[model samples]
Target: ENNKHVNDTENTLKRQKTNKKGGPKRDEVWEYFIVDDEKNDRHYPATYYHCEKKWQKGKLRTLKAHLSNECLQCPENISKFWRDKLSTELTNYTRKQKTIIQLPLKQYQITQHFSSDKPLPLAITERIDRSLLKAW
Candidate 1:
Protein backbone atom coordinates (compact mmCIF):
# COMPACT_ATOMS: atom_id res chain seq x y z
CA GLU A 1 0.00 0.00 0.00
CA ASN A 2 2.87 2.41 0.79
CA ASN A 3 4.60 1.58 -2.54
CA LYS A 4 1.35 2.18 -4.43
CA HIS A 5 0.90 5.55 -2.77
CA VAL A 6 4.45 6.54 -3.70
CA ASN A 7 3.85 5.56 -7.30
CA ASP A 8 0.64 7.57 -7.43
CA THR A 9 2.43 10.60 -6.01
CA GLU A 10 5.17 10.26 -8.62
CA ASN A 11 2.62 10.03 -11.39
CA THR A 12 0.85 13.15 -10.15
CA LEU A 13 4.12 15.07 -10.06
CA LYS A 14 4.99 13.98 -13.59
CA ARG A 15 1.60 15.10 -14.88
CA GLN A 16 1.94 18.46 -13.17
CA LYS A 17 5.39 19.02 -14.65
CA THR A 18 4.23 18.11 -18.12
CA ASN A 19 1.27 20.46 -17.89
CA LYS A 20 3.45 23.30 -16.66
CA LYS A 21 6.00 22.76 -19.44
CA GLY A 22 3.31 22.92 -22.07
CA GLY A 23 1.96 26.21 -20.69
CA PRO A 24 -1.54 27.36 -21.54
CA LYS A 25 -3.51 25.51 -24.24
CA ARG A 26 -4.43 26.93 -27.66
CA ASP A 27 -7.99 27.64 -26.59
CA GLU A 28 -6.71 29.75 -23.74
CA VAL A 29 -4.74 31.95 -26.14
CA TRP A 30 -7.57 32.21 -28.68
CA GLU A 31 -10.11 32.83 -25.97
CA TYR A 32 -8.39 36.12 -25.19
CA PHE A 33 -9.63 37.38 -28.54
CA ILE A 34 -13.12 35.90 -28.32
CA VAL A 35 -14.03 36.28 -24.68
CA ASP A 36 -11.98 39.05 -23.14
CA ASP A 37 -13.91 42.28 -23.04
CA GLU A 38 -10.71 44.29 -22.79
CA LYS A 39 -8.97 42.56 -25.66
CA ASN A 40 -9.45 45.48 -28.02
CA ASP A 41 -7.71 47.75 -25.55
CA ARG A 42 -4.45 45.91 -25.95
CA HIS A 43 -1.93 46.09 -28.75
CA TYR A 44 -1.96 43.27 -31.26
CA PRO A 45 0.80 41.63 -33.24
CA ALA A 46 1.77 43.24 -36.57
CA THR A 47 0.40 40.53 -38.84
CA TYR A 48 -3.20 41.04 -37.70
CA TYR A 49 -4.01 43.55 -40.41
CA HIS A 50 -4.56 42.42 -44.01
CA CYS A 51 -4.02 45.87 -45.49
CA GLU A 52 -0.58 47.27 -44.89
CA LYS A 53 -1.40 50.55 -46.54
CA LYS A 54 -4.40 51.22 -44.35
CA TRP A 55 -2.61 50.05 -41.29
CA GLN A 56 0.21 52.45 -42.00
CA LYS A 57 -2.14 55.32 -42.70
CA GLY A 58 -4.07 55.04 -39.49
CA LYS A 59 -2.51 56.11 -36.25
CA LEU A 60 -1.98 53.06 -34.11
CA ARG A 61 -5.08 52.90 -31.99
CA THR A 62 -6.52 50.17 -29.91
CA LEU A 63 -9.24 48.16 -31.59
CA LYS A 64 -11.76 49.74 -29.25
CA ALA A 65 -10.55 53.21 -30.16
CA HIS A 66 -10.83 52.46 -33.85
CA LEU A 67 -14.33 51.13 -33.46
CA SER A 68 -15.44 53.95 -31.22
CA ASN A 69 -13.99 56.49 -33.62
CA GLU A 70 -16.02 54.95 -36.41
CA CYS A 71 -12.87 54.27 -38.40
CA LEU A 72 -14.05 50.85 -39.45
CA GLN A 73 -17.28 52.17 -40.90
CA CYS A 74 -15.96 55.39 -42.40
CA PRO A 75 -16.49 55.60 -46.13
CA GLU A 76 -12.79 55.97 -46.89
CA ASN A 77 -11.85 53.15 -44.58
CA ILE A 78 -14.60 50.93 -45.95
CA SER A 79 -13.36 51.54 -49.47
CA LYS A 80 -9.85 50.67 -48.51
CA PHE A 81 -10.99 47.49 -46.78
CA TRP A 82 -13.00 46.40 -49.81
CA ARG A 83 -10.15 47.19 -52.16
CA ASP A 84 -7.73 45.13 -50.14
CA LYS A 85 -10.22 42.29 -49.70
CA LEU A 86 -10.95 42.17 -53.43
CA SER A 87 -7.30 42.22 -54.40
CA THR A 88 -6.52 39.39 -52.00
CA GLU A 89 -9.51 37.37 -53.17
CA LEU A 90 -8.56 37.83 -56.81
CA THR A 91 -4.99 36.75 -56.19
CA ASN A 92 -6.12 33.65 -54.28
CA TYR A 93 -8.61 32.71 -56.98
CA THR A 94 -6.02 33.03 -59.74
CA ARG A 95 -3.49 31.01 -57.78
CA LYS A 96 -6.02 28.26 -57.10
CA GLN A 97 -6.97 28.03 -60.78
CA LYS A 98 -3.34 27.93 -61.88
CA THR A 99 -2.20 25.37 -59.34
CA ILE A 100 -5.26 23.19 -58.84
CA ILE A 101 -6.79 23.25 -62.31
CA GLN A 102 -4.05 24.17 -64.76
CA LEU A 103 -1.24 22.23 -63.08
CA PRO A 104 -3.05 18.89 -63.04
CA LEU A 105 -4.13 19.40 -66.63
CA LYS A 106 -0.53 20.12 -67.60
CA GLN A 107 0.65 17.00 -65.75
CA TYR A 108 -1.92 14.87 -67.59
CA GLN A 109 -0.70 16.24 -70.88
CA ILE A 110 2.87 15.37 -69.99
CA THR A 111 1.90 11.82 -69.05
CA GLN A 112 0.10 11.42 -72.37
CA HIS A 113 3.18 12.66 -74.20
CA PHE A 114 5.40 10.09 -72.41
CA SER A 115 2.95 7.28 -73.21
CA SER A 116 2.79 8.37 -76.88
CA ASP A 117 -0.89 8.88 -76.36
CA LYS A 118 -2.78 11.43 -78.42
CA PRO A 119 -1.89 14.94 -77.26
CA LEU A 120 -4.43 17.07 -75.43
CA PRO A 121 -6.94 18.75 -77.69
CA LEU A 122 -5.55 21.87 -79.35
CA ALA A 123 -8.13 24.17 -77.76
CA ILE A 124 -7.21 23.09 -74.22
CA THR A 125 -3.49 23.45 -74.89
CA GLU A 126 -3.99 26.89 -76.40
CA ARG A 127 -6.08 28.05 -73.45
CA ILE A 128 -3.50 26.81 -70.94
CA ASP A 129 -0.68 28.47 -72.84
CA ARG A 130 -2.56 31.75 -73.01
CA SER A 131 -3.28 31.66 -69.26
CA LEU A 132 0.35 30.86 -68.41
CA LEU A 133 1.57 33.74 -70.54
CA LYS A 134 -1.04 36.10 -69.14
CA ALA A 135 0.05 35.25 -65.59
CA TRP A 136 3.54 36.43 -66.47
Candidate 2:
Protein backbone atom coordinates (compact mmCIF):
# COMPACT_ATOMS: atom_id res chain seq x y z
CA GLU A 1 0.00 0.00 0.00
CA ASN A 2 2.89 2.43 0.67
CA ASN A 3 4.44 1.61 -2.75
CA LYS A 4 1.07 2.08 -4.41
CA HIS A 5 0.68 5.47 -2.74
CA VAL A 6 4.10 6.61 -3.95
CA ASN A 7 3.37 5.52 -7.50
CA ASP A 8 0.01 7.32 -7.46
CA THR A 9 1.64 10.48 -6.15
CA GLU A 10 4.28 10.43 -8.91
CA ASN A 11 1.61 9.84 -11.56
CA THR A 12 -0.39 12.74 -10.19
CA LEU A 13 2.64 15.02 -10.36
CA LYS A 14 3.35 13.97 -13.97
CA ARG A 15 -0.25 14.69 -14.93
CA GLN A 16 -0.11 18.10 -13.31
CA LYS A 17 3.07 19.01 -15.16
CA THR A 18 1.82 17.84 -18.57
CA ASN A 19 -1.72 19.21 -18.24
CA LYS A 20 -0.80 22.85 -18.76
CA LYS A 21 -2.74 24.48 -21.62
CA GLY A 22 -1.14 24.61 -25.13
CA GLY A 23 -1.36 28.38 -25.31
CA PRO A 24 -4.13 30.47 -26.95
CA LYS A 25 -7.50 29.21 -28.08
CA ARG A 26 -7.76 26.98 -31.13
CA ASP A 27 -8.01 29.07 -34.27
CA GLU A 28 -10.91 28.73 -36.72
CA VAL A 29 -8.54 27.29 -39.34
CA TRP A 30 -8.36 24.04 -37.38
CA GLU A 31 -11.98 23.34 -38.31
CA TYR A 32 -10.93 22.65 -41.88
CA PHE A 33 -8.44 19.96 -40.90
CA ILE A 34 -9.37 16.38 -40.14
CA VAL A 35 -8.41 14.78 -36.82
CA ASP A 36 -7.51 11.07 -36.96
CA ASP A 37 -6.55 9.18 -33.83
CA GLU A 38 -4.61 6.38 -35.53
CA LYS A 39 -2.49 8.70 -37.65
CA ASN A 40 -1.90 11.48 -35.16
CA ASP A 41 1.56 11.71 -33.58
CA ARG A 42 2.18 13.18 -30.13
CA HIS A 43 2.53 16.76 -31.35
CA TYR A 44 0.80 17.37 -34.73
CA PRO A 45 -2.09 15.90 -36.65
CA ALA A 46 -0.93 13.51 -39.37
CA THR A 47 -2.68 15.21 -42.24
CA TYR A 48 -3.18 18.92 -42.73
CA TYR A 49 -6.40 19.46 -44.69
CA HIS A 50 -9.73 17.78 -45.29
CA CYS A 51 -8.09 16.81 -48.58
CA GLU A 52 -5.50 14.79 -46.64
CA LYS A 53 -2.39 16.62 -47.78
CA LYS A 54 0.79 15.99 -45.80
CA TRP A 55 1.84 18.72 -43.37
CA GLN A 56 3.67 19.03 -40.10
CA LYS A 57 2.20 20.47 -36.94
CA GLY A 58 3.14 23.76 -35.16
CA LYS A 59 3.23 25.54 -38.52
CA LEU A 60 0.08 27.56 -38.07
CA ARG A 61 1.29 30.49 -40.15
CA THR A 62 2.20 28.22 -43.06
CA LEU A 63 -1.12 26.42 -42.71
CA LYS A 64 -2.97 29.71 -42.78
CA ALA A 65 -1.08 30.90 -45.83
CA HIS A 66 -1.89 27.68 -47.69
CA LEU A 67 -5.57 27.67 -46.75
CA SER A 68 -6.13 31.38 -47.10
CA ASN A 69 -4.03 32.30 -50.11
CA GLU A 70 -2.40 29.41 -51.91
CA CYS A 71 -4.02 25.98 -51.69
CA LEU A 72 -5.04 24.80 -55.12
CA GLN A 73 -6.38 21.50 -53.78
CA CYS A 74 -9.14 23.16 -51.77
CA PRO A 75 -12.14 24.42 -53.71
CA GLU A 76 -11.79 27.98 -55.01
CA ASN A 77 -14.85 29.20 -53.15
CA ILE A 78 -13.63 27.76 -49.84
CA SER A 79 -10.24 29.34 -50.33
CA LYS A 80 -11.85 32.68 -51.14
CA PHE A 81 -13.98 32.53 -48.00
CA TRP A 82 -11.01 31.66 -45.81
CA ARG A 83 -8.95 34.39 -47.39
CA ASP A 84 -11.51 36.95 -46.33
CA LYS A 85 -12.21 35.37 -42.96
CA LEU A 86 -8.55 34.94 -42.03
CA SER A 87 -7.76 38.44 -43.19
CA THR A 88 -10.44 39.92 -40.95
CA GLU A 89 -9.52 37.71 -37.99
CA LEU A 90 -5.82 38.56 -38.32
CA THR A 91 -6.61 42.25 -38.62
CA ASN A 92 -8.70 42.16 -35.44
CA TYR A 93 -6.04 40.18 -33.57
CA THR A 94 -3.36 42.63 -34.65
CA ARG A 95 -5.50 45.57 -33.52
CA LYS A 96 -6.05 43.97 -30.12
CA GLN A 97 -2.32 43.27 -29.74
CA LYS A 98 -1.53 46.87 -30.66
CA THR A 99 -3.79 48.27 -27.94
CA ILE A 100 -1.61 46.97 -25.08
CA ILE A 101 -0.37 50.17 -23.40
CA GLN A 102 2.39 48.99 -21.14
CA LEU A 103 5.48 50.90 -22.25
CA PRO A 104 7.17 52.19 -25.43
CA LEU A 105 9.52 49.17 -25.48
CA LYS A 106 6.69 46.80 -24.53
CA GLN A 107 5.16 47.34 -27.95
CA TYR A 108 8.46 46.40 -29.57
CA GLN A 109 8.69 43.31 -27.41
CA ILE A 110 5.21 42.29 -28.41
CA THR A 111 5.98 42.68 -32.13
CA GLN A 112 9.49 41.23 -32.24
CA HIS A 113 10.97 37.83 -31.53
CA PHE A 114 14.19 37.56 -29.46
CA SER A 115 15.33 34.19 -28.15
CA SER A 116 18.99 34.93 -27.44
CA ASP A 117 20.29 34.11 -23.98
CA LYS A 118 22.88 36.86 -24.20
CA PRO A 119 22.14 40.13 -22.49
CA LEU A 120 21.39 43.18 -24.59
CA PRO A 121 24.23 45.59 -25.17
CA LEU A 122 24.38 48.67 -22.99
CA ALA A 123 23.68 50.93 -25.93
CA ILE A 124 21.86 50.55 -29.25
CA THR A 125 22.48 53.61 -31.40
CA GLU A 126 20.81 51.90 -34.39
CA ARG A 127 17.40 52.62 -32.88
CA ILE A 128 17.97 56.34 -33.41
CA ASP A 129 18.76 56.01 -37.12
CA ARG A 130 16.24 57.83 -39.36
CA SER A 131 15.67 54.78 -41.58
CA LEU A 132 15.06 52.49 -38.57
CA LEU A 133 12.71 55.01 -36.99
CA LYS A 134 10.81 55.37 -40.27
CA ALA A 135 10.57 51.60 -40.67
CA TRP A 136 9.25 51.18 -37.16
Candidate 3:
Protein backbone atom coordinates (compact mmCIF):
# COMPACT_ATOMS: atom_id res chain seq x y z
CA GLU A 1 0.00 0.00 0.00
CA ASN A 2 2.79 2.41 0.84
CA ASN A 3 4.53 1.57 -2.41
CA LYS A 4 1.29 2.16 -4.28
CA HIS A 5 0.89 5.52 -2.63
CA VAL A 6 4.45 6.42 -3.48
CA ASN A 7 3.93 5.39 -7.06
CA ASP A 8 0.85 7.54 -7.28
CA THR A 9 2.75 10.48 -5.90
CA GLU A 10 5.66 9.91 -8.26
CA ASN A 11 3.32 9.90 -11.25
CA THR A 12 2.15 13.40 -10.40
CA LEU A 13 3.47 16.47 -12.21
CA LYS A 14 4.72 19.28 -10.02
CA ARG A 15 3.80 22.86 -10.89
CA GLN A 16 5.58 25.44 -8.77
CA LYS A 17 4.26 28.96 -9.27
CA THR A 18 7.52 30.91 -9.54
CA ASN A 19 5.92 34.32 -10.05
CA LYS A 20 2.63 36.16 -10.02
CA LYS A 21 0.70 37.63 -12.93
CA GLY A 22 0.36 41.40 -13.57
CA GLY A 23 3.44 42.14 -11.53
CA PRO A 24 6.02 44.87 -12.17
CA LYS A 25 8.49 42.43 -13.67
CA ARG A 26 7.99 41.99 -17.42
CA ASP A 27 9.54 38.61 -18.20
CA GLU A 28 7.15 35.70 -18.03
CA VAL A 29 4.28 33.88 -19.76
CA TRP A 30 1.34 33.49 -17.41
CA GLU A 31 -1.90 33.81 -19.33
CA TYR A 32 -2.77 34.16 -23.00
CA PHE A 33 -5.40 36.30 -24.74
CA ILE A 34 -7.13 35.21 -27.93
CA VAL A 35 -7.25 38.16 -30.31
CA ASP A 36 -8.56 37.14 -33.73
CA ASP A 37 -8.89 34.04 -35.83
CA GLU A 38 -9.29 32.98 -39.43
CA LYS A 39 -8.67 29.81 -41.43
CA ASN A 40 -4.92 29.95 -40.82
CA ASP A 41 -3.94 33.12 -38.97
CA ARG A 42 -4.73 33.30 -35.27
CA HIS A 43 -3.45 36.06 -33.03
CA TYR A 44 -2.80 35.76 -29.32
CA PRO A 45 -2.28 38.89 -27.29
CA ALA A 46 -0.40 39.44 -24.03
CA THR A 47 -0.13 36.37 -21.86
CA TYR A 48 2.10 34.82 -19.25
CA TYR A 49 3.60 31.36 -18.94
CA HIS A 50 4.66 30.70 -15.36
CA CYS A 51 7.57 28.36 -14.94
CA GLU A 52 7.22 24.89 -13.42
CA LYS A 53 9.64 22.21 -12.41
CA LYS A 54 9.87 18.81 -10.80
CA TRP A 55 10.35 18.77 -7.01
CA GLN A 56 13.87 18.58 -5.60
CA LYS A 57 15.50 19.32 -2.24
CA GLY A 58 12.14 20.66 -1.08
CA LYS A 59 12.00 23.37 -3.74
CA LEU A 60 11.24 24.02 -7.45
CA ARG A 61 13.39 25.45 -10.20
CA THR A 62 12.23 27.59 -13.10
CA LEU A 63 11.82 25.57 -16.28
CA LYS A 64 10.87 28.19 -18.84
CA ALA A 65 13.86 28.64 -21.11
CA HIS A 66 15.53 25.45 -20.05
CA LEU A 67 12.75 23.12 -21.10
CA SER A 68 11.57 22.81 -24.65
CA ASN A 69 8.34 24.43 -25.81
CA GLU A 70 6.61 21.11 -26.43
CA CYS A 71 7.01 20.01 -22.81
CA LEU A 72 3.84 20.36 -20.75
CA GLN A 73 4.01 18.21 -17.64
CA CYS A 74 1.16 18.72 -15.22
CA PRO A 75 -0.19 16.44 -12.49
CA GLU A 76 -3.72 17.78 -12.72
CA ASN A 77 -3.88 16.39 -16.25
CA ILE A 78 -3.85 12.86 -14.84
CA SER A 79 -6.45 13.30 -12.15
CA LYS A 80 -10.10 12.39 -12.59
CA PHE A 81 -11.19 15.99 -12.10
CA TRP A 82 -9.27 17.13 -15.16
CA ARG A 83 -10.79 14.43 -17.31
CA ASP A 84 -14.32 15.50 -16.43
CA LYS A 85 -13.50 19.18 -16.92
CA LEU A 86 -11.86 18.55 -20.28
CA SER A 87 -14.72 16.38 -21.42
CA THR A 88 -17.22 19.05 -20.42
CA GLU A 89 -15.15 21.80 -22.02
CA LEU A 90 -14.84 19.77 -25.21
CA THR A 91 -18.59 19.40 -25.31
CA ASN A 92 -19.12 23.09 -24.71
CA TYR A 93 -16.43 24.07 -27.18
CA THR A 94 -18.02 21.86 -29.81
CA ARG A 95 -21.45 23.40 -29.28
CA LYS A 96 -19.88 26.86 -29.51
CA GLN A 97 -17.79 25.92 -32.55
CA LYS A 98 -14.61 26.30 -30.57
CA THR A 99 -11.59 24.06 -30.65
CA ILE A 100 -10.62 21.51 -28.06
CA ILE A 101 -7.57 22.45 -26.03
CA GLN A 102 -4.30 20.54 -25.72
CA LEU A 103 -3.05 19.79 -22.26
CA PRO A 104 0.25 18.08 -21.30
CA LEU A 105 0.89 14.34 -20.89
CA LYS A 106 0.21 13.67 -17.21
CA GLN A 107 -2.55 16.24 -17.20
CA TYR A 108 -4.13 14.63 -20.23
CA GLN A 109 -4.27 11.25 -18.53
CA ILE A 110 -5.97 12.78 -15.52
CA THR A 111 -8.45 14.46 -17.83
CA GLN A 112 -9.35 11.09 -19.30
CA HIS A 113 -9.98 9.64 -15.83
CA PHE A 114 -12.96 11.98 -15.30
CA SER A 115 -15.08 9.82 -17.59
CA SER A 116 -14.88 6.89 -15.13
CA ASP A 117 -17.98 4.88 -15.98
CA LYS A 118 -20.19 7.35 -17.83
CA PRO A 119 -18.96 8.08 -21.33
CA LEU A 120 -19.80 11.18 -23.30
CA PRO A 121 -22.55 11.46 -25.89
CA LEU A 122 -22.13 10.77 -29.60
CA ALA A 123 -22.49 14.30 -30.86
CA ILE A 124 -19.17 15.57 -29.48
CA THR A 125 -17.45 12.24 -29.94
CA GLU A 126 -16.91 12.60 -33.67
CA ARG A 127 -14.93 15.82 -33.38
CA ILE A 128 -12.56 14.42 -30.76
CA ASP A 129 -8.97 14.08 -31.88
CA ARG A 130 -7.05 10.98 -30.86
CA SER A 131 -3.70 12.74 -30.84
CA LEU A 132 -4.97 15.48 -28.59
CA LEU A 133 -6.45 12.87 -26.31
CA LYS A 134 -3.10 11.14 -26.04
CA ALA A 135 -1.26 14.42 -25.59
CA TRP A 136 -2.71 15.31 -22.22
Who wins the lDDT comparison?
2
Cα lDDT, all candidates: 0.42, 0.61, 0.36
Best by TM-score: 2
Of the two candidates 1 and 2, the one with more favorable TM-score, higher being better, is 2
Q: Sort by lDDT, best first: what order?
A: 2, 1, 3
For model 1, residues 17-125, the per-residue Cα lDDT tens digits are: 4446554542211111212122243323321121221232222334323333434443465446545655675688743345545454433566664755667789989
List, residue by residue over 35-127, the lDDT tens digit for candidate 3. 111233221232122223322221111222222232354333333444464467568874446787987645466557587678778766755
Give the higher-TM-score candidate: 1 or 3.
3
TM-score result, candidate 1 = 0.18
Q: How many residue pairs in model 3 have overlapping backbones?
A: 13
Model 2 C-alpha RMSD to native: 19.2
Question: Any idea what lDDT model 2 has?
Answer: 0.61
lDDT of 1 at 125: 92
Error of 3 at 93 (Å): 0.2
